[model samples]
Target: MPGRDPADRSRRRFARRQWARRWLAWRYLVAVVALVAVVGGGLWLVYFSSWLSVAGVEVEGVGLLSATQVRQAAAVPQGEPLARVDLDRVRARVEALAAVRSADVSRKWPDQVLVEVEERVAVAVVEIGGRLQGMDADGVVFRDYAQAPPELPRVETGATTGSEALREAALVVSALPADLRARVDHVEASTIDEISLQLHDGRTVEWGSAEDSELKARVVADLLAARKAQHYDVSVPGQPTTSG
Candidate 1:
């Protein structure tokens, strides 16, 4: 056999080096794919297993509502997967509760649900069908009336029984000045077309419509300030008359 030429030997060495480089490139790709598979498998196991069950529920920003009541309102079951919980649905349910003004629901890592509730602050006591109840600005009755809340107004309206009436009355009460608000004794909404306010000072404000309550309240305050009178008739806008 003839001995190999130096040129042939050099060429063979170069080809072997190229083959080794290609093999190493393939090995690196396999290693990367294997690592990704391992990580994906681990994550799938953790997500599918019962390890992420809800262990507890946390409530925050609650004042008028009790923790138990808030938890009941949320209605999120323990041991349920945190991922499966519907935060928006829970928040909507909580808001449906008469006492809750607004609600925020979120998940805490791995094992807890965080619920923050903003309770409705009572603005007045409303009389519906002769039964007195406490209500907030959204016309939701939260509690039965007792002695009137100090510094809060009393709203009485024929339309106060339903949600629409409550909403209108709330808008009216919200428009009153804070100082005048405490002075208001009772508000009467005897008809959908008219509303009247009774002041603690033995005066009555004839507020015919819920429209422009803010403007009407301001006018009423100005009249009361101008003359320490007993009654104001503001059913007609831009022309207010007072009586003593």
Candidate 2:
């Protein structure tokens, strides 16, 4: 081996260099092929594959509304790509139902559309056309009750009372503490500024505007607990008075 020619050694070294260059080129080619395969597979899975298509709709957070009702309202097309479903459009449709205050629509990956809804809760009932309508805390009248539920307070509005007055009455009722609110028989709103609460015991509370309602609620509760009265005047909560 020590007697090898220099030209032979040079030729062997050159052959090794050529082989290494070929291996480096093959590595780049394999990497490029792998990258292309990954990109193509991702595109097919998201846009052209049926494996991730919508198969059904799911509903949540519904009490007054049935899951079937919410699904129908959502109107999510069966077999459409789940990633392609328009969530905003679905949400708007679900919210169109009177009982649904708001809704959130989303894709439950792989095959379902999810609809979560917030239903309106009644804080009081109002008589409109001899039918009792449930009113939420925001004073939006919705849902007709066949018979008034005993737990919720009623709101009595004069023929001249407008929606604003009814809103004020709702605010006054909502401000009262639960224990105190339970004692109220009904609320009367002659005008936005003229709100009153009538108790079941033939007693009345002159509640003024919706302003200072929290203070007024506290004052009325304290006055009732401290003394027996036929009439309570907490219109000016800072200086409350009562009379029998």
Clash number for model 2?
0
Q: Please report, in order, the local distance difference test score of every candidate based on alpha carbons.
A: 0.80, 0.91
For residues 1-244, what per-residue lDDT tens digits would candidate 1 score against the true structure?
2798989989999999999999999999999999999998767655555788788889999877788888887889787777788899989988898888788899898799999888888878876667778888776788776566666778776533456666777778877888788778888776544677888878998887678888888888888888777778888769998887
- By TM-score, who's the top model here? 2
TM-score of each: 0.83, 0.86
lDDT of predicted model 2 = 0.91
Q: Model 1 misses residue 111 by how many Å? A: 1.7
> Which runs in model 1 stand beyond 4 Å of their true positions?
1-18, 21-25, 159-162, 228-230
- lDDT (C-alpha) at residue 219 in model 2: 90
